[model samples]
Structures are given as structure tokens and as C-alpha cells.
Target: MKILIADDDPSSILYLQDMLGEWGYEVEVAVDGNAAAEILRRSDGPLLAILDSMMPGMDGIDVCRGIRQSDTERYVYMIILTSRVESEFIVAAMNAGADDFISKPFNDEEMRVRVRAGRRIVELGEQLRRRASRDALTNIYNRGAIIEILEKELSRQGRSQHAVSILFCDVDNFKAINDTHGHLAGDEVLRVLARRMAATLRPYDSFGRYGGEEMLGVFPDCGLEGALEVAERMRAAVAEAPVKTEFGDIDVTVSIGLATVDKDQTCKLATLLQRADDALYRAKANGKNCITIAH
Candidate 1:
């Protein structure tokens, strides 16, 4: 894990850097509190931070306050390093969102133990986040996470003016599959189909279970033709192979509805999703196991 050290004290910074380095942690140093806050704001930056209680521009408490207010995807575990371990100061730090605190003239063994605990907490938070964002049965992204991905892709497309497309795929006669076999058998079908559909998509493409037996796919930089091609490929991948389940081998197919956002279209994430959903309904109306492009 990457650790951010924010302090104005040169001697303390050097000693702590060497100690943490020896402990096998990647270190990022900030001479002032403002710099440390900026690093924390980055999406791909460090998840663990140590901030000096009194630094130029911003203090450790101030940085902790900013971190707590920010809407970051991942949780950041923060420790406030203070020379004075007064009761009021400790209370203030905790109120400002410091997860832990370390006193100055810190003992080497104590620092190691505190940091070790912080690392465990950070890792556990990430594990919970993954579980929350993933589908329990298929182990793919869940509806909320996929919708967030779509929104993120839409924002990226807005900046780059690159084509972005989405597909709404529904398992054809899914309820019937559950009725004919059992819910367990239906679950097996969904699991097998999720793996197969994922195989058909590019590594960069985003695929997720959008609740029930419907899946959503996002294709970045893909126009109408490319989206249609990928959709057809996924359709055929499922139809060509029977999903082997513990219950039995079950034939399954999907109807796909594709929506593309070109440079000319001013669309929101919800708009794109609705268009794809409408197209999916049309595909089912015409026939199952086919692809329909939203006009």
C-alpha cells in the first residue's frame, strides 16, 4: 500500500520515511498539508495517510476534514501525527476524521503496530466495497456499480467526443427456465452465461448483471457498427453453446438492444439506458435471440 506522509518537519519526515520503507511500504512525501490534501484528492493515489498536526498552509486535522468531505470511491485511513498528545487535541483530531493518532518522539515498534492495524482496516474496507459492488451469484458488477460505470463513461465521452455505446441484454424466457427446471438450475444458467458473455467482450469493456436475468454492457469508443458487431457476437456466443449446469445442460439465448452515443448526440446516462431498454423490448417483440439497434 502507498502511504502519504505530510509534515513540515524535515528530521521527522526523513526518519519516518526510512522506517516505513524498511517496513515495505511505498511512501509519498508532502512537505506541507496542502500538498498532502491534493494527493488524497486523486482517485488513484494512496489509501493510507499520516499528516502532521501543525504544518504550513493546512494542519493534519484540516487535511482529515477535507478527506472526510470528499466523495472518493475508496476509503482512506488517516493518522494524525502530533507532537503534543493533549486530550483536547486528540479529541479535535478524532472529530476531524483522523482514524488514529501517533505522538511525536514516536517509538519504532508502536508506529509499526499502528500502521499494521491501519492497513488491515483499509484492506477490509476495500473487501466490503467489492462485495457491495458485485453480484453475489454471478460475481460480476451489480446494477448500481454498472450504472455508475455508464455515467463515468458518458463523462469521459463528453470530454473526448469519442463514441460510446451500451447494450441491454435479457435472457430469453428466463422465467420459463426457472419454471421448467428449478431456481437453482436457473442460477446455474445465469452464472454460465455471465462467464460466456464476459469472454465475448473486450477486456476494457464493462459488463455487469443489471438485476434478475438482464445484463448491461458498456463499449467505449465504439460506434453503431462496432456496437452491433459486439452485440451479435455475444448473442451468438450464448446461443451456440448450451450452458452446462449441475442440473443438466440447458440451451439459453439472449436478446440484445444496443444504443450508441455519437459525437452529435447530447445524451445523459439515463437517456442512453432508456433507449437501449426500448430497443431490447423491440427485439423481444420481433423475436428472441436477436439484436436490435436503437435508432
Candidate 2:
């Protein structure tokens, strides 16, 4: 694991680095809290940090608070190390978002135990984040998560001039499958279709479950024609396969609607989603299973 040790004292920094390096951790050192914050802002930070409570300009507590405010992949497991262990000091550290605490003139065994516990917390946080972003049944991105991603992508387009297309899809005759067989059969079909669509799409193309019987896909850097081709391929894949279920083999089909991002559009994500949904309705009305590009 990568570890960051921030202290103004040279001797203390070297001692902690040598101790952690001996324990098989890759260590990086910063002279003060300001330097530590700069290091975190520059590179992807270490999983765990050992910060001295008192330092020059931007103390350890301030640094920790800044990190908590920033949205980054580094889940910093911070251990506030200081000579003072008063109740107020401990409470201050906790409020500043310290994951663990260690007193100066530290015992080696206690430091090791605290660092190990911090690592466990980082692992647990990563697992929880993954679960929150993923669909339970199809293993695709969930509705809430993909909507968040869409907003980010839209913001990026405003700043960087990148183009994106949104495709909304609904499984045709899904309710009929449930009525004829069962909900389990319908679920199996949906799961299988999701997997197949994901496999066929490009790596940058993202697909997600948008609620019951509906899925949404976002293709970054793709225009109307490209999205139409993708929709056609996905439609063919679903029609060609027979989904296996407990009841029997079930045939499934999908209708897709495509919408390209316009340079002059001032609409929000919900408006874009509504347009795709309207196009999807047109696809269903024209035929049970086909692709429709929104005008």
C-alpha cells in the first residue's frame, strides 16, 4: 500500500518512512501540511496518511478538511499524530475526519495496529462504493449512478466541446412474458439482454438499467448514425437469442431511441432523457421492435 507521512521534523519523517518501508509499504514524505495537500492534489494520493497535527501554514486538521471536501479516488485513511492527546484534541481530530489517531513517542505495536485498521476501512469504503454504483441483478450501472454520470458528461461537454449521444431502450412485450411465464422469467430475460448489450458495445459506451423493462446507454463521441448502428446491432442480438429461464426458453426483442447532443441545446439531463423516451415510443408505435432516431 502507498503511505504518505507529513511532518515538519526531518528526523520524525525519516523514522516513520523507514518503519513503514520495513513493513512493505511504499512511503512518500512531505515537509509540512501545505506540502502534503499539494502532493495529494497533484498525484493520486496514498491510501493512508500519517499527519502531524501541528505544522506550518495549513495545519494537519485544515489539510484533512480540504481532502474531505474534494472528490477524488484516493480514500485517505488519516492518522493524526501529535504529542497532545487531550479529549478536545481527539474530538477535533475526529471532526476533521481523521480515521485513526496516534500519540507522539508512539509505540511500534500500537502504530502497526492502527495502520492495519485504517487499511481495513479503506477496503470497506471501496466495496461500498462499488455496490452503490452497480445494479444488483444485471451488474450494470444502476439508474441513480448513470444519471449522475450523465450530468458529469454533460458538464464536460460544456467545458471541453465533446459530443455524446443518448440511447433509451425498452424491452418489447416484457409484460406479456411475465404474464405468460412469470416475473422470474422476465427478470432472467432482462439480465441476459443486459449482458449481451454490454458485450457488444464499445468500452467507452456505458449501459445502465433505467428501471423496470427499460435500459439506457450513453455513447460518448458518437453521433446519430453511429448510435443508430449500435441500436441496430443490439436489436439483432436480442432477437437472435432465446433466453433460458426456469419456465422455458423465452424470445425477447427491444426498441431503441437515439438522440444526439446538439451544440445549441440548453436542456438538462431530464429533458434529454424525455426526448429519448419519446423517440422510443415512436419506435414502439411504428413497429414492436426497431430503432428510431429522434428528429
Candidate 3:
């Protein structure tokens, strides 16, 4: 993990930089609080930051407050560095969203422990984020994450005008499977199909569990023709093999509905999703196991 050191004092920056480097951390340096704030706002920036309390502009507390106001999805653990360890100052820094604090002329041992703790906290936050975004049953992205992915794709398409496609997939006769075997067996079938179909996707493509017995696939920079090929592979993945569960072996087939936004067109996320869903309805109406495209 990378750590950012933001301070104006040359001697203080050099001392802290050397100390942190010795502890095996990749260090990023900023001469002013404004520079530090820019780095902290980046999505790929370091998770841990040490800010000087009295930088010339945009002081440590102000920077921390600024970062807290941005997206709270991916957390940045911030520590305020100050020469004074007064109770009043510490209280003010904590209120501004500083995760930890270190006083100037700081003890080397204390700094080491705090840095270690900061990394652990950042990792824990990431784990919690993953847990919240993933579906509990199939281990794919949950419904909310799928919608988020769709929105992001639409935004990117508007900028680049590159082709994007989506697939709406539903398991055929899923409720019948539950009635015949058991709910546990049906769950196993969903998990198996999710893993199988996901294995066939390109590196940039994403597959998610949209809801019960339904899945969504997002394809970036892919046209209708390319998406059709990918959708066929996903359909075959489910039909080729029987899912083995505690109850029994069950045969499964998946129906896919594909929608594409060509490179020349820009559309809303809702419109794209609605087209795919309508195509899915057509696929179901045509036959149980098949693929249909929304023109």
C-alpha cells in the first residue's frame, strides 16, 4: 500500500519520508496541502495520508474535511501531524475526520504502530465494501452494484461514443426446479450457472446477479455482433452440464436477451435496461431456452 506525506517544512518532510520508507511503505510526497488534497481525491491514490496541521494553504483539517465530503465509498485513512499535542487541537482535528494523529518530534515506535493500524483499517474497509456489493447466493455482484455498473457504462459511452451492450438472462423453469428438487438445489443451480457463464466473459465484461433466477451482463466496447457471440457462449455453459447438488443432479438452460448501443448513439441507462428487459420477455415468449436481440 502507498502512503502520502503532506508537509511544507523541508526538514520535517525529509525525516518522515525516510522513516516511513524504512518501514517498507511506498511513499508519495506533496509540498503543500493543496497538492495533498489533489492526490487524496484520486480513485487510485494512496489509502493512508499524513497531513501537516499548519500548511500554508488548505490546512490539514481543511483537506481532511474536503476529502470526507467526496465519495465515501472508498475510504482514505488520514492522520494529522502537528507540533502541539494540546487536547483542544486534537479534538478539532478529530472532528474534521482525521483517523489518527501524531505529534511532531514524534516517537518512532508510535509512528510505526499507527501506520500498521492504518493499513489494517483500510483493508477492512475494502473487505466490507466487497461484502456489501456482492450477492450472497451466487457470489456475483448484487442488484445495486449491477445498476451502478450500467450507469457508469452509459456515462463512458456518452464520452467516447464507443459501442456498449447488455445481456439479460433468466433461468428457464427455475421455479419448477425448486418444486422438483428443493430450494437448496435451486440455489446450487443458480450458483453453478453463474460461475459457468461468468467464466466465458471477456476481461472487461461484467456479470452480476440482478435478482432471483435472473442475471445481467455488461459488455463495454462491444457491438451487437460481439455481444451475440458472448451471449451464445453463456447460454451453452448452462445447458452443457448438469449441476450436481446434495439433492440430485439437475439439468439447466438459460435464456438470454441482448441489447446494444452502437458507437454512433448515446442513450440513458434506464432506456438500455428497458430494451434488454423487453427482449428478455420476447425470448421467454418465443421458447424457454433461446437468445433474442433488441434491435
Find the candidate with the highest TM-score and give its number: 1
Model 2 alpha-carbon drift over 4 Å, by segment: 1-59, 71-76, 81-92, 103-109, 126-136, 199-206, 219-240, 262-265, 285-289
The ten-residue window of minimal lDDT in model 2 covers 262-271
Candidate 1 residues 1-295, lDDT tens each? 9999999889988998999999999999999989999999997789999898999998999999998998778889999888888899999999989999999878899999999999999999999999999999998899999999899889988988999999999999999999988999999999989988888888779899998999999999899988888898899989998888777889999999999999766698888999999999999998899999897
What lDDT would candidate 1 get against the real structure? 0.92
lDDT of 2 at 128: 89
| Cα lDDT of model 2 by residue, 201-277, tens digit | 98778889999989999887777778888888888989897998989998888999888885444457888898899
Decreasing lDDT order of the candidates: 3, 1, 2
Q: Which pairs clash in the backbone of model 2?
A: none
Task: Predict model 3's lDDT versus the native.
Answer: 0.92
- lDDT values, one for every candidate: 0.92, 0.86, 0.92
Q: At residue 57, what lDDT does model 1 achieve?
A: 95
- Candidate 3 residues 1-295, lDDT tens each? 8999999999988998899999999999998989999998886799999999999789999999999988646799999988988899899889989999998778999999998999999999999998999999999999999889888888889999999999999999999999999999999999999999999999989889998999999999999999999999999988998999999889999888899999999988888889999999999999868999996
Q: What is the lDDT of residue 283 in candidate 1?
A: 95
